[model samples]
Target: MAAAGPGQHPGNRARLIARFGPMAGPWHDALPTLVDGLARRWGLDVGEAGGGGTSRVYRCRRDGDHEGVAAAVWLKLTPDPVVATQEAEALSAWSATPSVVRLLDSDLRVGALLLAGVEPGTRVRESGWRTADVARLLADLRTAPRTRTPLLPPLGERITFMYDMAARRGTHDPEVLAHGRAAALGLAGTGPADGLVHGDLHPGNVLVGPGYRLVAIDPRPTFGDPDFDAVDWAIDGATDEVALRRRIAELAALVPGMSAARVLAWCRATAPLTTGAPAFLVTPAGLRG
Candidate 1:
């Protein structure tokens, strides 16, 4: 096979160039060649390329049987080497109890990771997310970290990034976005750090693995406030305050050490990022943002 690069996919190169600018052009242009190299180095039968997030993802299969690891695997390659390194560290920390996808191997220098594939690969949102399942996963996540990662950024930094990006997009309500960012930062400043926060734990990031288990992927990890991660689930598909409140209560009750108050705070603070769900910014009772 020859090195195809992003030229094979007409839109991908343009998207990468737009997002990461000229510096990303060489990387995208060389991606296919790099994929070929990875397949050779890691014994992978690389399949079709995928488009999502900040990474180039591919379906793959290991050539040899490995203990515990599945034959079917997924490879994530990114342009940012540091992001890849931190992602590996985050995944490794979450792999003991493994509420997230299992990390098989990684090449941090190349910003690549080989991951165990989910059997069905169904996004929980598409499957109609259940609060209980999310609660279970969140609970397990608290105990998932058998290793510590001191280098990970805090939740505040991730929150700042989201608000800043929203400003650049010029889509979200400025008042709401600013309020959300400030509130979110306050929440991040104080809370239990039992586990690493999966900074981007929206429904798209949660997938159904084998045994109908809910596993998370693509963590933009933060080291503060696990409850901050539950905001997405609390607000997911909730069109009104009653529904949001109910979900928050259930999640808080089901997940040990989860605080309903904190989750609500997070939801209010991050509502602008999700387009303010109902314009009240995920209201609860009389209080409104």
Candidate 2:
């Protein structure tokens, strides 16, 4: 991944101001001091910053470490307190699992997290990896020990909210949410709650890591049917019906407890709920209150 320029993502401040209105002012105002405080507290030499819409992320080097060589870490600062808390709790739950990035440290009060950076950090999407490979890694992540974190909503509740939001937005076709609701209900009844789910496990989020062949970043960390974690691959990027069906089949075989029919249901329900106006998109990233 490229180093972020200056503070957080380029143009992120403008976007935040636009999205957050008056309340955003304080968040923006506090960023400089927050960054400085975190740097000094953690002995981090904050470097370039970059991330998507919700947070400011930067590459930083540990200033001092008597234990061994000082390591490079990714520092993320989320504006949403709920998101910050959820992310910190999730990373701690994961505890450096091979499937996801490790959390080195965190300050929930200030919404700062020190994450282990993936060396040779290559996104799986850019790595020329096959669908099967991504599916295997996702399945592996679903196998991590489940953490009883109370921050995340249940899979069922989340699906209901998506439907309600779609109705409120009037952007997506009604039938889509209907089918999604039905699928979600069916999957909820049938699928096992085996582990913590990376609520957003698309290709952009999975990266090649140093010790792990594939590690995921930016997790929503919800408790749900493990198969729910496998649905993103079907509708993530460029794909047609044929491609989608093939990917679903491939994923089902690779991911235990997930089926082609179940994956299809999730896609039909999830795609419309996610791909829409800015509000719809940002809702899932913990931007919506």
Candidate 3:
């Protein structure tokens, strides 16, 4: 699907300012020059635009390569340079993990990243995700950095932010607040920062890569229990206990060091934090507060 280039896409400019505000005004105003500079600096022949929300990605190729000779690449530019720096750190740590896209080069000064474009580039949401593939992607990301770094904060912090935002928006379901809010809060504070996680590994963030393998992209990198990453996958398109439990079982069995019980708890804890809770979540027992 072709996308409208920057400043052309409807509402994208407002969303951009709303997301980064005046702090990034200079960068927003200089987008064209930035793209040209990046193309020259990286020896890329910039092509069409793609990706949305918080970043803009352009499909491009190396300087003299034709379509069939050299692999195409993506230029991911972010409104916030900090996000680029942090993701650069996370991607470097996971460079050996084939499930992640290789970060060819990054210019943090301009909040831009040159990333390897996936073959077939089909989003999992479009192709459908298999539990085993999802688990493999999760397991591949379980690598723990030798020393804990601030680049990866605990997954709970991300959850807290989501919960706080939901609360601010007054979007919580009544039953959810009555039953799941306590669960969400408790889960937010649970655990040691054990391993690396693609903190926001939703279906849209995944794509089919070479050899028909699933490749993860745009990680909201975080640490602590890999199980936290499983919640989104477990609940995606799952509208009942039967479906969700089945996913939890499949993912737990395949993901190293993960358990069905933990994944379920995380789901129960987070179901309310998210706006659309599947009908079967029913709020765990004793979570009243």
Compared with the true structure, what per-residue lDDT tens digits does model 2 show for residues 113-183?
A: 89987878888777756776777676777666675656776667666766776777786556655655665
Backbone clash pairs for candidate 2 read 4-49
Give lDDT for model 2: 0.69
Candidate 2, residue 161: the lDDT equals 65
- lDDT for model 1, please: 0.78
Ranking by TM-score: 1, 3, 2
After superposing candidate 2 on the true structure, give the runs of residues whose Cα lies further than 4 Å from its correct spot. 1-5, 8-11, 17-21, 160-171, 174-182, 236-242, 274-289
Q: Pairing residues by index, what is the TM-score of model 2?
A: 0.80
Q: List the residue pairs that clash in candidate 3.
A: none
- Expressed as tens digits, the lDDT of each residue in 50-108 for candidate 1 is 86647888888777655645388888988888788888888888778657898999998
RMSD of 3: 3.4
Worst 10 residues of 3 by lDDT: 1-10
Q: What's the TM-score of each model vs. the native?
A: 0.90, 0.80, 0.87
Model 3 alpha-carbon drift over 4 Å, by segment: 1-7, 64-68, 144-146, 174-182, 273-276, 282-289
lDDT top scorer: 1
Q: Which stretches of candidate 1 lie over 4 Å from their true place?
A: 1-7, 66-70, 146-148, 282-288
Report, for all candidates in order, the number of backbone clashes.
0, 1, 0
Top model number, TM-score: 1
